[model samples]
Target: MSKTNLDIQLKTIPESAGVYQYYDKEGNIIYVGKAKNLKKRVSSYFTKTHDSGKTRVLVKRIADIKFIVVETETDALLLENNLIKKHKPRYNVLLKDDKSYPWICIKKERFPRVFPTRRLIKDGSEYFGPYTSMKTVHTLLDLIKGLYQLRTCNYDLAEDKIEDGKYKVCLEYHLGNCQGPCEGYQTEEDYQENIKAIREIIKGNFKDSLGQFKQQMKDYAEKMQFEDAQRIKEKIEVLENYQAKSTIINPRISNVDVFSIVSDESFGYINFLQISYGSIIRSHTLEIKKKLDETDKELLELAIVEIRERFNSKSKEIYVPFKVNIGEEIKVTVPQLGDKKHILDLSLRNAKYYRMERFKQIKITDPDRHANRIMAQMKADLRLSEEPRHIECFDNSNIQGTNPVAACVVFKNGKPSKKDYRHFNIKTVEGPDDFASMEEVVFRRYKRLLEEEQPLPQLIIIDGGKGQLSSALKSLDLLGLRGKIAIIGIAKRLEELFYPNDPIPLYLDKKSETLKIIQQLRNEAHRFGIEHHRNRRSKNALNSALDTIPGIGEKTIVELLKKFKSTKRIANAKLDELEEVVGVSRASKIYNHYHKE
Candidate 1:
C-alpha cells in the first residue's frame, strides 16, 4: 500500500460502472460502494476534501481497494449491496434485526397438529408463514379453532392402537375442542375434511372452505336443528371476517414476493412482503447501515434475495420498484398502476415508516441536529433552493367533456393540510381540453390567493407532463410569479419529473421520500378532483331529468326531489306521493309522462 503502488492501481482502474471494496491494514473490508465510473469515483476520495469526519477517516484507513466491473450501473449497485450485507463491514450500515420470525407449521402426522414454531425442520410439514407478528399467528389459530374440532393430545393416533381402545376421552374432548379421534369416536375420513379446510385457510384460499361451511349450515337448517344451524352460521361469519381482514389486494396476484427499499447516505431500510392469494401473510422491514454510498436498486435487490431465502419463498415473480439484476430464474416486474403498483407502494411505505421511526428514536437524543439533517436532506433530495415546507399539487378531471373540474391539495410540513384544499369548476375551458383546463385552474387558484394575500406554496406539482406544465407556466408568467415558486410536472406514466426549459425529464429514486410525497400529492389531487366532478355530474343528472318534466317548475322539482330523494324514486312514486310533494296538476303531469313511457 505505498503511494506509488496506489497511483499505479488508480491508473489501472477502468472508467466503468462496478462495485468497489476498501480493505484496511488488517485485511478486513471496511467499506463497500458502487459507482458509475470507478476510476473517477475512487480517485476523488484521495484528491478531494471531505467535510465529514467519517469520510476523512475512511479515506485514511483504506490500505487497499478492489473493484469488480459490471455491465450496467444497476448491476454495480446490486453487487455492492449484496457484498456489504454479507460482509457486514464495520463502516457499512447493517440490518438490525436480532429476533427470528414465527412460522405456523402443520405437522404431517396422523390427525395433524397445527401450531406456531420458530424452527424449520424438513419433516414434510407444511409451513404457512414466518409471520412478522405473533398476534397475527394467534389470530389465525383462534379463527381456525372456532371453525373446527382439533385434538390437543400428543398420543399417537395409529389405527391399530385406536382400534385396541387404549386411550380414553380427554378433557379437550369433553370440552368439545376435540372429536375424540383417539377413542374412535370420530372417523378419520371426517376429521381429514376439517384438516383439508384448515389447509385451505392457511394458504389464504377461503372459497372452498366457505362453500363447505355454507352447505353444512344449510343441512342443519333443513333438518330443523335451529341451534345447530345458528352455530354453523356463526362459524361461517367468523371465517368470512378473517378472510376480509387478511385479503389486501387482488386475489389473482397470488404467490409473489414484494420488495422495496428506502435508503439515505448512512443507512437503508428494506421491507419484504410475502403475498399468497393476494393477502400479505408475512411482512418485515430490515434496517441496513450503509458502509458507503449504495444505490436503492442495489440495496433492494440484495434485500430481496436475502429475505426470500430466509422466508423460504418459492415465488417465481417479484414486484420491485425498478429493474435490477437479480437473476434469470425470477421475473422482475416494476408495476406502474393498478393493484400491483398499490402493493409496491404499500411495501415502500412500510420501509419509509420504519426509517422514520428509527430517525425519531435517534432524534429524541439530539433533536436540533436531527431536524437540521432532515431539512438539509429534503433540500438536496428535491433539488430545491429551500426546504419545501409548503407544497401544493393541481389535478384536472373530466368525463367525456362533461363536468370538468380541478382540485388543489395542499401539504404543510410533509402532511396533508385538508383545510387548505380547494376545488374549481372549469369555467373558461370548454370540452375536455386538459391543457386549457390546467391553465384556467392554475390561474384562478393562484390569482385569488395572490389577491387575498394568502401564503404561496414553496413547491407546485402539476399532475402531468410537458403540456400541462407549459399550460401552468403560462399562468405563472402572466401573474408575474413564474420564478417565485419551484414547480415541476410529474407524468402519470413512468413518473418522470419535468422541469421548465429542460427537455429531458429527471427520474428520482423510486424509494425516495421526496418522490413518494410527490406521488401522494398527485393521487390526492386526482382523488379530490374526481370526487368533485362526480358530485357535480350527479347533481346535474338529477336536476336535468326532473327539469324535463312538463308543469314542473324549479320549486316543484325541488319539492319532489326533497321528498323522493332521486329522479328514479320520483319516477317510481305513486300519483298520491307525487301530489304530496308537488302540486296536483304537476303531479298528474309527471305521472302521465312516466306512465306513458
Candidate 2:
C-alpha cells in the first residue's frame, strides 16, 4: 500500500477495544497486538519512536493493516492470543512447546474405564489432565487403581445387556482387580459413587475419598471382615500419603494458577503452576524467545494466556509476582505474605531453575551463545557502554606488612585466561600501603601493555573499596585512559561494588550470575597474589642467611646451595666437598661463616 492509503486507513480505524494485525506486502501477518483503544494504539505505532531496532524494522515492513473490533478488552485479549498462536507472527515472542502431554481419561461407557492416553477425543468422556510427563500420569493412574475396584476391560455393562447375559467375568474380575460389572456383579449407583470419588481425587482433593475409605474400613471391621478392613485401611494410608506429598500450602487456596518469570536479554522463562485444594496438579515452564526486548510484564501476561489455553485451565484466579494488565475476567493477585507469597516465590524459583538448566545445556552445546549472553548480562548489570569481552581484575597481598605484591588476572569471555595472569612486586611502595601499591602496579601493568601495543581490557576490577578504586583511576588518568575503560572496586566486607565518581555502592544480588563472576575474578586475583607473595617471602628468608658472608655473592651462594641444598647442609659439608662446588677461597670463607654460626 502507498503512504496515502496507509494514512487513510489509520484515520478510519475505530476508537474501541480490538486486536490489530500488521501485514507485509505479500500478505503475511508479521505482528499481532491488542489495545483498549484501536485508533490510538495503532496510530502510536507509526507516530512514536521505538527503542528496539526490530520494532522499527517491523513498522517499516508493514504494507497493510487489519483489525477485529471487540466489545470488551477481555475479548480483545482473547482474540489477540488466538491469532498470535494461529499465525505465529514473525515479530512476536515465540511460544515453542511441541510435545503432546498425556491426560487421564475416564471412558464414556456403562462401566467406565480409567486409562492414560496422549490423544484426546471428544466422545463425551471426561479428561482430567494434560500432565507435564507420562510418568506423572502413570503414577496418578496407579494411585486410582489401588483405591478403586474399576474394570480394565472394554465391556458394555448396560442393564439390558447384563440381563440378557451377553458378557462374562474376565481375568480382571477373577484377580479381584474389578467388581465384575460386566456380569451384573456391581450396580450402576455404587459404580457412579466410586467414579465421583475418583473425579475428586484427580482434581487433587482427597478429603472426600479419605473419609469414604475410613468409613468403609470401620464398617468392615464392625462386621468382623478383618481382611477387607485391612485392605481399606491400606488404601486410606495411600491416599493420605499422596495428599501429604501434593499439599504444599494451606488447603483453602485451590483452583488457582500461579505464574512467575525470569528473563535474560534474549529469552524469557515463565513458570506456571496449577494448584487445586493446596496441591499442585500441574507445572510447566515456557521459554519465549524475545523479539523486541519485551518486558517481564508483557511476556508473563502473554504466557499466562497461552499456557492456560494449552493446559485447558478454567481457573478464575492467578497469583503473580507483580501487577499486570491481562484483562478483567481472571483475578490477578500480587501476593505479599504468608502461603500465597511462598507459592509465588516457588514459581519464581522454578523459572530461575529452568533458566539455569537451559544455560548449562546451552553452554555445552553452544558455547558462543552462552558467552554472548553472559557478556550482555555483565554489560547491563555493570552499566558499561559495551560488552566486557576481555576483563582484568587486580588484587594486592601484603599480610603482616611482608612481601607486598599484586596480581593481575585476565578473563576472556567470562572465563579465566591463566596465561595472561601477571604478578607484580611492590617496588615503589613501602610497607603494606594497599592504595599506593595498587596505583604503582596499575600504572606499570597498563604502561607496559600500551608500550607493547597489547589489547586493553574493556573492564577493570580493583579488589578493595573506594580508596583503592581512586588509586587505580589516578593511574588510568595518567595514561590518558581513564574514560576509555570501565573500572569498579569490590569491598570484601559487604561485597559492595564502588564505581569511580559514584558515592553510593551497588550491591548486586548474592546469587546473580554477574556477581558470581565478579566474585570469581576477585578470588582468583587474591589467590594468585598470595601465592606469589609466599614465594617472595620464602626466597627472602633463604637469602637472608646467605647474604651475611663478606666475600660470598649471589652466584657463589647459588653454587654452594646447588651442591649442599641448604644452609644447614653447607655448614656441615667438609672443605673438599665445598671446594668441589665453589672456588677454594670462597669455599673456605663459606665454611668458616657457617661453622662459626
- Top candidate by lDDT: 2
How much is the lDDT of residue 430 in candidate 1? 69
RMSD of each: 14.5, 2.4
Q: Ten residues in a row with the worst lDDT in model 1?
A: 91-100
Model 1 accuracy (lDDT, Cα): 0.86
In the range 1-597, model 1's lDDT, one tens digit per residue, is 877878898999999989889999899999887788999999999999886677789988988989999987757755776786689788775654333788888888998888898888999998887788889899889999989999878889999999998899989988989999999999989988988989888878889988998988899999999899999999989988888887999999898989998776567888998888988888889876655465687677667766776667889999998897676668899999999999999999998899889888877887765655555566787688998788899998888889899999998777799999999998887689999999998999889999999999988999999999999999999999998999999999999999999999999888676788789899999999999999999899888987888667898887777787788898999999878877688889999988995
Put down candidate 2 lDDT per residue, 368-483, tens digits, no spaces: 99999999999999999999999999999999998899999999999999999999999998888999999999999999999999999999999999999999999999999999
Residue 409 miss distance in model 2 (angstroms):
0.5
Shift of residue 148 alpha carbon in model 1, Å = 1.6
* Lowest lDDT 10-residue stretch of candidate 2: 92-101
Clashing pairs in 2: none
